[model samples]
Target: MSGPAAALSASPAGTGPDQVRGPVITGWSAVSPYGIGRDAFVQGVSSGRATVSVLDTERWPGPDELACLVPDFDVREVLGKKGTRSMDRVSGLAVTAVRELIAESEGAGLPAGGEEVALVLGTTTGSAQSMMDITRDTLIHEKPFYIDPSHIPNALMNCAAGQCAIWYGLKGPNTTVAGGRASGLLALNYARRLLTAGRAHTILCGAAEEYSPARSWLERHTRHPDENATVLGEGCAVLRLQPPGTHPHPLAELLCITTAITHPHHITTTLAHTIKRALHQTRLNPHDIWAVSPSTPPGTTADHERHALDLIFTDHTPHHIPAPGPIGDTAAATATFQITTLLSHHQQHPQPPNRIALITAIDRDGVLATALLRLL
Candidate 1:
């Protein structure tokens, strides 16, 4: 009981019965480029080792030759040889992450499965390669409509979430949210709403991304020509969220999640305003945030995000925890990874009670999101 578990059980000096409470993160798991599970991710980020590796052109030919992929990740091998023949990479990643999360929850003396537990998964697009391949087969076959039915499920945008629910027998609300890099935060917000509405008692929330030639080519064509290409990364991170005071060993309390959309030219100002609003709503000042994790990929968006952060924290500079440098551009999973990064850092450094951590995410489609978490 000397680690996070102990911290959660002890009441902080200033906290009282009147203290406000929000959704609490009780447990989490990750399937990351560094390897798999929360320990691998924490170790990789803590060691500051590079996870990028050379791609095999024969297997994954694409515009980019390098990527940060979950090493030695084979669907059948990792998930076993049953019911995985037609499983796409994204679905496999999601299922694996949820499986780990359920196990972690059970280990922490919580019921891992029940009718009231929900699942909310976020993604930019389910599996680009599965969709493209299915389309190619449809046109090249003797009959235009002839295609593998087994692969059809993977082509849908909700495939990963559906697979997770099916695998876990989750009877509560199952949802899929799509918002590019802002997807993780969007999913978190969705889970919070579900709790507030009394739709579920517990929620498994996170995002998953897969690295493939289809996604690589799509990113290449969509990116601005002047911007330098970053090494694409893929993985999944899932957190178990329960209503505040429901869990005894909570890791952090989520105060607020705010998002905004604006014209590309006004992104900086809009994001600054969004951050300020989140702070005001939480009744916390800039100096209260002990760390900041910003989803900075590269180029103009990164500059705009930095500018927005500078605008708010003019007097107090929080410790920066960068996500992309070690994990690459995780796309949909960026924000989720940022939260995991803060959690992992807290485990090692043991921040004081009630200290805050902030996360900001921006997507190329003019979506900006901010979340504030109070460490236990």
Candidate 2:
């Protein structure tokens, strides 16, 4: 993440470590097939759109023609070549989106001078495309170790997070996460807990993933394509969690974040349970939530992913398919987009009281992460 100094209120009055509420997501940006920034996302969701082109169809090992491409974004505008070369497109997306997020609200998502900054990320596949490149060198070209050793660092799961820390000059706790699509929500929950527990005052927390060439090959070979409905898309969401307070452009107050895993058939029940548990944790009522940013399915579960989700939390308003659905890509982008949408709802219309925004994601691994965001 880049931009102005965002300072969290250190030792706010009347709040100790246990009393400290979870992080309030000040701002965020998403780079997806829908395009760059939040404006494109709102448009896509407004139209009920999805990317149509065949995914990774080429046998020659390269990116697919059709993707939810972010419109008009160049790294050079934000970083010099020296800094940009170390990052892959996926990591570039991860860092740039966070930078835009930080730009919206200066220095709130990060620590001021002398404060600790932790890096926690969630991703299903680290940089599988890089790995695929190396494998291609060996198999397709019969060239052993033909890949660049410099590019080998991104092959690990935590490489993205580590590189982000180095690139951004953050020197605090750092880690990576992989829980399938649930990685994003889990990352947020974990970061929130760390701040609450006083492990670190601030964090650059998010996840990164991409539809790699390897994923495409695997899907083509897999007998059951439906099993891989979750698209192999790459995106990341970085939220600077600070003790609860009024942020100038807060999409919503991240009241509570929680997760669970259940059978695919019982997803609705598990989702409801997670929502209930979050509410119980925060002492919130169903009617308090004005809208929900629910997850969209990629044909894995029944087409009734929304119906199944609504059956659990039918009392609240569910209008748009919030967040990731707008982009038609999978990963933590859903949760991050959900959070951004929740905050945007309140940002657009001020004084939206009790404007609780709920974000829920059902992952392929049967993991359900439900986050409660309040626009207080």
Candidate 3:
């Protein structure tokens, strides 16, 4: 996540009139490997302690691998056993994170019911374990529709957001973005659009990933063999976003979000362009950015991202923070963590008002996203 930078091309041409304002993040919640709450996450990352540990070899047999997995997280304890009996790990994480977010913002001008709020979540892949089980049942079982009825709901990529809506009563609109590592930014941008368009007054936007034996196996085969590649991690984080002027004291104001899709080989250039476009759209100079949170995956992708950053901030050296180093690569959850980490850093350091931060993420599919935020 932290590395040398690069510059993007010329500023994005102005789109002229009728541009909508960005959304403001009023509240946020995180469930990470560090612990069950945002405070645990901030303390762990700020203290600079390593959170990565080896998964149980017997249960996750494979090469010696490291990961940042949530410790002793049981959904039954939080959501109770009845409904959770069918909830998969990812869905449970999403539900818990959303609950925490709404709880924390009880009287902070949030929507009163499900019809007033929308949910948009991101993911790399949906519930790998449940998908595997469903596939296995389809292949091995002798009868049609032999898969467990309990597993069906969890198999979809949109299950987390759908389940969150069900559990929290969020009924305005629900969406799922499969943007891989860039999922968080994609979801944020979508939520912002919803707010800007007056489609919803408030929205829950974030990302989640689960560390399971099935996911580990997929990574072992698909991920490159570079030592710098990050260990896999799992967690869910959600931000409660509202239109500007709606919340009296927002944590931060989201200024702009930009994304670009390209071929996989063009990740570096596309990412640089996306960041440049976001800054251009926000009308901010690179020097105006006080800090940068980059979602760097392992291997050549990391190198490409570092190079892109080096190019972007050639004049001033912004604080380069790597979101994945402490928590490992959390797939779709990486960018949400990055945004939260930026907020957390400001909370501890108390930066001057109106300072800006930039967050960027790139997925394996060559989806590049950049979000510009201004702290108040």
- For model 2, the run of ten residues with the poorest summed lDDT: 1-10
- lDDT digits (tens) for residues 320-362 of candidate 1: 9877466788899999999998899889888667777899999
- Runs off by more than 4 Å, candidate 3: 1-21, 58-65, 227-229
Per-residue lDDT of model 3, residues 137-209, tens digit only? 8989898588789789889999988999988788898999988888999999888777756678789999999
Expressed as tens digits, the lDDT of each residue in 1-376 for candidate 2 is 2111122212222233333244666555666666666665555545557654454455325434544445444556545688676566567777776666556546554565415777788887787777777666677665776667777776676777777777666677788877776777888877876766667766667776665566556555642467444444545566666555434444445577778878877776777778887777777667666667776646654343566556655666544435555455655556665665555555555653445567777775578887776555
The TM-score of candidate 1 is 0.94
TM-score of 2: 0.79
Q: What is the lDDT of residue 181 in candidate 2?
A: 63
Candidate 3 TM-score, true structure as reference: 0.91
Question: The CA-based lDDT of model 3 is what?
Answer: 0.81
For model 2, state the Cα shift of residue 373 in Å.
Answer: 1.1
> How do the predictions measure up, each by TM-score?
0.94, 0.79, 0.91
Q: For model 3, give the RMSD to the true fold.
A: 6.3
Top candidate on TM-score is: 1
